[model samples]
Target: MVTASSLGLTERQAVILTVGFYMITALIMVSCNKWALNTIELPWLLLWCQMMIAVILLKVTHSTGMLKMPEIRIDVSKALAPLIAINVLGLGVNTLCLVYVDTSFYQIARGLVLPFTVIFAYALLGQPSSSLVLASCFTVFCGFYTGISTEVNVSQRGVFFGIFSSITTSLHAIVIKKSLPAVNNSSLDLVYYNNVLSMLVTTPIVFLSGETSKVMATLETEGFQAFHSFLAAAFVTGIFGFLVNLAGFMQISKTSPTTHMISGAVRGVLQTLLGYFAFGDIITTGRLSGIVLILSGGAIYTYAKDKEMQTTTKPTYIPMTQQDVDGNEDNERKA
Candidate 1:
C-alpha cells in the first residue's frame, strides 16, 4: 500500500491540480450564474449577493485566523478604486450578457478578451508586441466575428454587452497587473479588498437601477417558497463565485499569467461543449470553426509570448570575490 508520504505530489503536480480546480470552479460559476439569471431575472442582485457573501466569508476567515487580513489604508483603497470599479462594471455587464444570450454564444463572444487585452496593454501600459502576436489577435477577432454572425439565436443586446464586458475585463486585468504589487497584498487579501470595494460600489447602484424594488416585488408575489429557493441559489452561487476567485489567484500565484491564460482557453472549450450538452445549444459548423480558431490563436499567442519572455529574461550574474574563489579551491583540495 502507498503511504501518504510516498504519494506526495511534486510542485508541478500541485500547480496542475490548482489550475484544474480553478477552471472547474470558474466554469461552474458561469453556468450557475446563467441559470439563476434565466430563472430570477435579477443579475445585479445576484452579483451584489455574491460580493456580500465573499466579504462575510473573508471576515470570518480572518477572525478565525484561517486567513491574514491585509492592512487597509486609505492610500491602498484609493489605489485599488479604479480596478474595483472596472471589475464591478465588467461583472455586471457580463451577467447581463448571460441573461440575454445563449450560453454557447456567450462563450464564443468572450473570445474577444485576449485581443482586447493586447490592445489595452499597448494603449495603457505602452507594452509592445510582435507582428505574430498581432496577427494571432486578428485571427481571434475573426473567430469572434464568425461565431457572432452565425449565431442563430443571437441577441443584439447580448452582443453589445459582451463587447463591453470584454473591454472592461481586459482593462481590469491590466490594472490589476499594474496595481497589485504597489498594494503589497496577497491574492486572498486582494480578493477581500476587491469584494469589499465592490459591495460598497454596487449597493447604491442596485437601488438606483430599481433592482431592489424588483427584488422586493419578487419576494412578495413569488411567495416564501420561491423567495427561499432564489436565496438558496444565490447563496450557493455566491460560494462558487468566491471559490472561483480564490482558485484563480492561487493558480496564478503558483504559475505564470501565461499559464493561466492557456488554462482559460481550455476552460472556454470545455464550457462551450458543456453548454451544448447541458442546455441543448445548437452547434453549427461556423461555431466549431470559431472555437478552433480562437483556441488556436490564443495558444499561439501564449507560446510566442512565452518564447519572448524566455529570450528577454536575463539570468542574474553574481560576481565571485577572490576570497570566495580561494574558499572553493580549498574545499576542492580537501575533497
Candidate 2:
C-alpha cells in the first residue's frame, strides 16, 4: 500500500534499499563493536579510533562537496558543550558495558534507553504522552527487567555501567533535541560537532584510563601481526560506525523518530540472534519472552505516537448549507 513517494524515497526501488541499509548498518555496528571489544580488550582506544575515522570520513565528504559542513562558532560550541560531553560519556560507558557484558545481555541492557528517554522527555522537556503510550513504556520496562532477572552469569559492574549509559544516552537525546535549533536543525551538523568534540574530550581520557599502555604492551608482546589485526578491526569498525551514523540520520530525516525506534527494536532482535549464533550466548524461554514483550511494546508505543501526531496535524473542515452561503453573500453586499 505504501509508495516510494509516500515515504519520500527517490525511486520505487529505494524504499526497501534505504530501510535495509539503515537496519543492516546499525546491526553490523553493534556486532563489530562487540567483536572488537572482546578481541582487543581496549574499549576506549577502539572508540577513539572509531571517532577519528568518523571525523576523517566527514572531512573527506565535505571536501568532495557531498555534504556541507557547518561552522562552529564560539557561541554555538558553548551551547553544545553539555550535549557533547554527555554524548561522549554515554558512548564511553556503553563500550565499557559491552566489554564487561555478554552481547546478548548487552542488547537487553541497552533496552533501558527508551524508557529513560521517555522519563527525561517528560521531566526535562515537559512533553507528555497519552496513557496508552505510558503503559506501553511500562511494558517495555517490564520486558527489560524480565531479561535482566533471567540473565545467567550476569556482570554487576556491566549492569551498573549499562544503567548509567542509558541515563546519559537519554539525556543526550533530550539535549540533542534542545540544541538542534541552535545548530540550524541539521542532524549532520550535530554529528560533525559531536564527533569533533568527542575526539577532543576522549583523547586524554583514553590515555588516562591506561588503555594506551595496555595497547603498547600488547603490541610489544604480540608483535606487529597483533597490532595489524587490531588496526584492521578498528578500521572496519570505524567504517561501519560512520555508515551507521549516516544511515541513522537518513532514517530519522526521511521518517519519524517513532519509525526509527521501531527499526531499532527490530535491530535489537537481530543483534540478539547474532550474539547467540556468533558468540554462543545462552537463550532461555524467559529471555525470548522478554524480547517479544520489548518488541511488541515498542511497536505499540510507535503506533500510538504516530496516531497522536496524525490526530494533532489533521485539518478540520466545516460544512455549510446553501442558506448559510446566501446569508454570507447578503452580509457581504451590505458591508
Candidate 3:
C-alpha cells in the first residue's frame, strides 16, 4: 500500500503496520508484568540492566566500525536547544503521566493530541490548518470516546493524565517538525539525541534516594528463572523501543506533521485490539465504532488536506533534476 507521496504505505497498510508494531509492544509489556507477578520477586532493575547492555552494544558497534555514521552539523545555537528541550519534557511527562492513568482512558485521551497539535501549529508557528484537519481531530476524539465508553467507566485521573500526554506528545511533534529543516541530522542522530536527553532527565529522579539500588536488588534476589524472564523482556523492549522510535521519527520527518499525528492514531486502536487478544479484554461495539471513526477520520483528513495544499501551495516534494525519478528519495535525503 502506497500514498500519493510515493511512499510505500496505503492507508490500510499504515494502520496494519502501526498496529503490528504496537500490538507486539503490548504483548511484551503484558508478558513482562505477568512474569513479574508470578515470580517470587520481580526483576525491577531489568530495564536499567538492559540499558547498560545497550550501551555496551553501542560501544562495541562503534568500536568495530559497524555503526553507520549519520550526517551531523553543529547547531547548538539554533534548533537543537528547543527541539531537545521540547522532546525532553514531552517524553518525560508522557511517561510519568502513564503512572496516573489507566490504559483504556489513556487511549481515548490521546485523541485530544491532534487538536492540540493543530492549534499549536496555527497559533504559535503560524501554520494554516484546513477545516478537514479540524474535523479529523474531532473525529479522533469521538473515536476515543467510543472506544472507552463501551467497556470501562473511564477514570477522572486517567482522563487528566491522558490529556496531559496528548498535549506533550503534540508539542513533541510540532517542535521536531518545525526544527527538522535546520537540524540537518539523520534519524539515527535524532534518536540518539532524544534518548540520551530523556535518559539524563529521567535518570536522576528515578534513581535518587536509592530507587535504582532497590530495583537492582529486587532483580538480583529474584530466582534465576525470574531474572532470565525479565532479561528477555527487557531485551525485547529495548530493541523494539529503538526501532519504533527510529521508524516513527523518520516517517514524521518525511510527512506532514498532521499526517504523522493521524498515522499514530493507529497505535491506540492496535493496542486496544492487542489488549483484547492477549489480556482477555473484550472489545465492544462502541470500541469498534471508535476504531472506524479514527481510521476514517485520518484517511479523509489526510487526503482532503493534501489535495487542498497541493492546489494552493507546492507539493511536499519537488523533483529537482533528471536523476530524481521518484520524489521520495529526495525527501528522504532532505529528512
Instruction: Please tell me which predicted candidate would have the highest lDDT against the true structure.
Output: 1
Candidate 2 backbone overlaps, count: 0
**Candidate 2 TM-score over all chains jointly:** 0.83
Alpha-carbon runs more than 4 Å astray in model 2: 1-20, 306-335
Clashing pairs in 2: none
In order, candidate lDDTs are: 0.75, 0.74, 0.55
Q: What is the Å distance of residue 1 in model 2 from its true position?
A: 29
Q: What is the C-alpha RMSD of each candidate to the true structure, in Å?
A: 8.0, 9.3, 6.1
Which is the winner by lDDT between candidate 1 and candidate 2?
1
List ranges where model 1 is wrong by over 4 Å: 1-11, 313-335
- Compute each candidate's TM-score over C-alphas: 0.86, 0.83, 0.70
Ranking by lDDT: 1, 2, 3
Task: State the lDDT of candidate 1 residue by residue for 1-335, as single tens digits.
Answer: 22222458654466568789999998999888877876778888899999899888888888998877776678888888887888889889989989888777776777788888788767876777798889889889988899888877778898899889878866764566555654553566777888888888998888988987887787788766666656877898899989987787666544544456668778888888888998888888998888888987897797777566556544221112122122222111210
Best by TM-score: 1
* Residue-wise C-alpha lDDT for candidate 2, range 205-324, written one tens digit per residue: 999999888877877898767766668889998999888876765554344344455677788889889989998988887778778788778877877765664566432211121221
Who is ahead in TM-score, 2 or 3? 2
Report the C-alpha lDDT of model 3 over 39-112, residue by residue, as the tens digit: 32222233343344444455566679877534334553345667766665554444334444433334555667
